[model samples]
Target chain A: MKNTAIEVLAVKNLKKSFILHNQNSIELPVFDNISFSLKEGECLVLAGPSGTGKSTLLRSIYGNYLTHFGEINIYHNQSWINLVEATPHSILNVRRQTLGYVSQFLRVIPRISTLDLVAEPLLEQGETEVHSINRAKDILQKLAIPETLWDLPPATFSGGEQQRVNIAITFVKEFPILLLDEPTASLDQKNKQAVIDLIINARDKGTAIIGIFHDEYVRNAVGTSIFDIEEAKHAA
Target chain B: MTMSLQNPLLKVENLSHYYGDQIGCENINFDIYNGEVLGVVGESGSGKTTLLKLISGLLCPNAGSVAFDTRIEGLRDIYKMSEPERRLLMRTDWGIVYQNPKDGLRMNVSAGANIGERLMAIGNRNYANIRSDSSDWLEKVEMDLERMDHFPETFSGGMLQRLQIARNLITKPRLVFMDEPTSGLDVSVQARLLDLVRGLVSKLGIACVIVSHDLGVMRLLSHRLMVMKSGKVVEQGLTDQVLDDPQDPYTQLLVSSILPV
Candidate 1:
């Protein structure tokens, strides 16, 4: 058992519900009164069937989706900030250095080259052009991106290529906490292996990881603890 | 863990070099067999990088010889070969993976061209065949084949590193020199890249000389270990033995300093 004293993230009484206007104005409760704690170097895998709001729970912690009620507290530096009540500026600051999210899509400015897109975070962090570009190039190479398309917009890239580029940008920084949503869905065997290795490395470095992995192999390889949303629903 | 000892693919004997009066490395000796991985680890200012440069032909050693076993020439001193001969050897029989992909890749050309250039250098001319081979290598390094035409200037760091690996390994080089191949990325990215490297090295059965300050990397990939301090070897043995039970105090500190996960 992990000590809650050193917990990086703690959720208490987390609840979410939405009005189903199309279905007689009924209110659909996703999950209620859920509490858990995640420590450093621990991964909590949200395992359940589709439509279980697995992604919703992850986004709520990231402050993208607002919950009906509950406390999503994330420990930053020393004190804990309640995501459900924190201001936008605090959320932004926490996201910059402490939290990272790798969704299933690659969102970038149109016409921007792949290199600039991936180098944006480092460049924003005040890294020099030479150093940032060099670092960006290093990550791209590890993800198996060919050089010729680096200057072109990723809009024209295949699904797997774009996903790899997305992963590259998110992983380029070393955030203390990460949320992964099917990070390797479009990857092949070799690429999947690469992603798995990256996840393991991050965990070993004491990053708290929370993710939803539909691939059983990947889930087994990366998950240290399971957070079954379906079971949570039943328990509630 | 053990590689074929039959014909030591590369032999470095009494190798010594200097940058002005300062020592680079002195009297370094080792033999890398076919499909062997030799790890060199030390703190900053150690001669590990310099020794790698010397062995990979980037820097000429002031003394001793680097002999390689070639199919046609048998065991011949690499320094004695003509410039063209040495260049050919580099293209066909040897590969070097730089710590920074920027140092090893051509940023102007398309990723496919970067990989295909090596094949063209070695007399391959069919455009279709070259393109096909480049695509295959891209896949091998986990890159999408569709981006073969993209220039390296726009690639992310991890993507560029993978492309560089694919570019260097496409020619099926028998021996590879890697300089901190997994440094400067987040731990997760580094781990993935290291796994890719380990898989490729073993699949291709290529001998390698890897240099890194991270003892974890050395333990994960190296078959034999060489510890250096003050430009001299202090302890050398199997990777596990040297890491688990160090004879030198420097090595002991290094092993103990690994942050617990």
Candidate 2:
């Protein structure tokens, strides 16, 4: 286990629901009163069956979804910001600096080469183009993405290949907090092991991580603690 | 990260425009930092163009102010400035590329003259320097130096657009407003143009507000996106986040409507 003295992320009394406005304003409650906190060098794996709102919980913490009530406080740049109340500009700033998210799919601008896509985050951090491209090449090679495909866009890449590209983009830079959704779902055993190693390395570097992994082996390999949403709901 | 720490280059607050009772755009607000790109996307008549015009000072807004950090004055409402001051700012510090290349270019002027006009406006009188800078920009936009004296009317749609880009960027403007820059071009041409625009924007560290209905363009160039519906901003966020997991219903529809090739 690593040191848990410095808190990186905290969620308190979080609640969210989907309103079907077109369908007579029907309400679909996803989760309620869910709360968790993560410390530096900790990986909290969200454990639950399908439809238990594991992904929803992660999206809420990332500020992609608006919660009905609660606070998602993040410690960034030696300050605390409630993501629930932060402006979009501040959220983007926080995302650029402290938060790194790897969703299930790779979303990018069309016609952008894979190499440039992966190197973008570093460029945003003020790295020179040459250095950023070199670092991207190293990470892409480590993820087993063939050199031939690095020049092409990920739009035509296979499902597993695209997932690896998504993973590579996030891992190219070290972020203080990471939220990953099914990163290794489409990856093979070799690629899965590589991702696991990357996660462990990030954790050892004092990065707090929250991930939802369906694979039992992956969960066991990286998780410092498991937060079961179903159990939390029952207890609530 | 360094971008957010700096003061905003342009700040727009509660901007709204009305054509009599009809709305152009309502209650718009955004701040653009140096080297940042903000994309506005919406279907036809979503006021994307109107919003651009409002901020560029081409059209006056009924409400709100457009604050710019000028070189002389710190930050002032552009709409309130004297007409000459505003025109000088437009000529010196800003560039606007219209949807139709013809709208922004001079029909009778040679390509070199078009690019050199802005430099001359800012008081560059040496003929050799002007000629060399114009040729350099033409090459930067990937046009042949041989075509420096060719008229824009003789050029193809893609070439015309590239010339427009070269002309706008010659002044090294701090902010650029692009309205549907890649539309009406072949796919390959569009791709090349997008790549060129992306390269130049980052290389020059020029802030841009680009209005396009093409999600691919938004995904390619913008750091942040604001989705418009009718005349209101329905949603806005980081480009990848907004597109990957769109929260608004309209944005979801718009995103799903794209037919995969």
Instruction: Return the clash pairs for model 2, or none.
Output: none
Q: Which portions of model 2 show Cα errors greater than 4 Å?
A: B234-261
Q: Candidate 2, residue A42: CA error in Å?
A: 1.0
- Per residue, candidate 2 scores C-alpha lDDT tens digits across B164-234 of 99999999999999999999899989988988998898878889999999998898789889999989999
User: Which predicted model would earn the best TM-score?
Assistant: 2
Query: Cα miss at A87, model 2 (Å)?
Result: 1.1
* All DockQ scores: 0.01, 0.34
TM-score of each: 0.53, 0.92
Cα lDDT tens digits for candidate 1, B1-261 = 124337789999999998899999999988888777889999988999999988887888999999999879788888888888888999999999898999999999999999998999999999999999999999998888888999998888888889988999999999999988888777767867876787687667888999999888887788778999878888776675577546566776677778974
Question: What lDDT score goes with residue A86 in model 1?
Answer: 76
